[model samples]
Target chain A: MPREDVEDLELELLLEALYRHYGYDFREYARASIKRRMWRRMMEEGLATLSGLQERVLHDPACMERLLLDLSINVTSMFRDPTFYRAVRDKIVPLLRTYPFIRIWNPGCSTGEETYSLAILLREEGLESRARIYATDINAAVLQQAKEGIFPLDRMQEFTHNYLRYGGRCSFSDYYKVYGDRARFDPSLLEHAVFAQHNLVSDASFNEFNLIVCRNVMIYFDRALQDKVHDLFYRSLVRSGVLALGHKESIRFTSHADAYEELDRQEKLYRRVL
Target chain B: MVVGGSWGGLDALGQLVALLEEGCSLALAVALHRAADSPEGAMVSYLQSRCPLPVAEAEDKDAIQPGRVYLAPADYHLLVEPGRFALSIDAPVHHSRPSIDVLFETAADAYEEASGAVILTGANDDGCRGIRHMKRRGGVTMVQDPCTAVRREMPDAAIATGAVDKVLPLDQIAAVLNGLGRA
Candidate 1:
């Protein structure tokens, strides 16, 4: 076969093997991006080719697990995009306070950074005691990291800066214990959390949420996937609930735009409308 | 060469990778520098359609080949081993797995005298040390022109090391890489 044809075949075979063996369907993703990521995996894994990498991933459950980790993006920090978090604090928290029992979802909670950020905000607003936060991600590895709640001490100054920018009222250091090179967050901050594995792409909404924070995660999806996620978030929210997206992401083009009102246009914060 | 970037990185990298020839002689690796936990691949796919090279996510222990583009998976640090790619659970470097530093350093070690490193648009100084290492090891070092970078910090930091061989815009970086690959 021509090298050109061979490469094309390899790409298809690799995608098929991934779906058949791992049950992770990325077949519909934007191919160039998927191809880029898979090829990088090929180089990193030292397989010399995508076909070989696909073969290993097909047969080795551990390799499949690792591949899953590789495919998911996890860049997150507590109170990431401070201005966005502040918007939630100022506009959404007061509304959430009215509820007797509130359920909040931080989908794609990546290492629990945003989850804890929301927890801190809720605590400061006197709502932590009544709220239950479900922090979910498809990657088990990051979920484990989230459970540990340990961050590098060197980053505290920056995290402190972000915390303050988000209207934090206390010393950011008050949230964690400095342990050598690591800072372990106060477990009490997570008292209301139930961390779980959830594939936003493949899974349905499991429970209703008064506020859903899916920041910065949806920009990777194609229109179909984005729409599906929008529907899921809409289904998950109670009436007059809130949905927060990443700064670059918006519901403006989605079919569900009319379902939610923009609470903060700049922050991409929206409130569900009946 | 799989190119991965996030935030200001997308446009910068898009400009860089858009330069590969239809039958280029070198493979590309990318550490998208994104959240470590979101499972979605579209950016590389979009690039592949326009570039002459085939693109895909980098899997652990995958082999390198010319004329192909690779992207690092979300959570894993995409690294270059002796002649292969490997993934690690080691903590995030510069708060990112599939870090630019991790990919460049490991690629420098593996390719040693044969490697080339480019630091494009980024908000942080993640790729500077790696680019420096690549330079010390005889790899060609390049940075996107900080003046033109959407996020200047990354390219600026790389240039500050004084190890970079060229500081070109996105389009120019593509031309340089194509020239080197052809040579």
Candidate 2:
């Protein structure tokens, strides 16, 4: 047919190869964004077509790892949306305080920026000892960086601004020390946190949680995939537990729309009502 | 329908939407260059106050509906699927988030021949390539006549490509769009 249609066919074959060979199912991700990422990686690898990239991905483990990084969409920042964290402090923290212990899941926690931010919030609220954060991602490469808790020092200024805007209680610099081009976060911030590689697509619920902060992750998933993950979240959360999503995300189109009550609509926080 | 503007966009957008009238029978996805941290939902509220069509800032997975208006939320690239809206934080194209190119390209791919693109007063050329792609895909392409635009550069850039199907004055855009929507 058309050349565009041919490219789409190539894209489908490559994604299928990626899923079957790698067990990393990106088949359900949003088409436009995922396709763009595929093209990006293809060009980066000096390959001209999706099929050509697929061959290298299957043959070279190193190629797969690099492609994984792009597909994971690791773009994030400390308190990326400050208002969401503000709501977590004002509205969600009190609910966490009701419980003697707290389990927070940070799914798709790429590079641990927000995970550390969450830990800092917990410590500030004096909930550090009582709370345990399960920071997980589909890519282990990012999880290792998350565990290290170091970020580009250049980004510190923006994160510091976000921290202040969120009404941070202490000097933002108190949390980290500069090391070369990086700023290494205090180890205590990660003491109660565990990092792991968890696949949201095929993995089952491992534990019930008091709060699940999965921001900016599902925007890359399609409708069916979003519904599947929402079901997992619904099952993974305790009754009245909080679910925070990316600022512009909503539960309205998902299967669990009626199951959760809006805790903060603008911030996309929902409380499991039933 | 995909609509794009940059500099001097607000007045042109306001007048265009006001003239589109109620029950226009087409979904309008608009992208204008605005800073990411501008007052949240302020533009949507402003547009809603003047436009006959229902206006709101886009949210993920929002289904595109006829006669409704959707604005690209700040700092995010707005994309389209067959019948819904998708948002992305992917690095900005043409130095703009909610880049006119992103919206127009995806909308053209999804809607194909049924899509229409209108480029209006912009200082930059973000929407030019998109309108060209839209024309190649059998979509209708229109631009505000450069002479009538506040910043003639954007429209002039689009017209230079010879891809625009029609180049109308800013005031006359609504009538052509309404007619196209009906057809």
Candidate 1 residues A107-225, lDDT tens each? 88878888988899889889999999999988889889898999988878767877987779888888999889999999999899999999887898899889998875664455577
DockQ scores for all the models shown?
Answer: 0.05, 0.55
TM-score of chain B taken alone, every candidate: 0.92, 0.97
What C-alpha lDDT values do all the predictions have?
0.77, 0.89
Model 1 chain A is weakest, by summed lDDT over 10 consecutive residues, at A27-36
Model 2, span A19-63: residue lDDT tens: 889888988898887887888899999998888998999999999
TM-score of chain B of 1: 0.92
* Model 1 TM-score on a 0 to 1 scale: 0.64
True contacts kept of each: 0.00, 0.42
Model 2: which residue pairs collide?
A: none
Model 1, position B128: C-alpha lDDT score:
78
Segments of candidate 2 deviating more than 4 angstroms: none
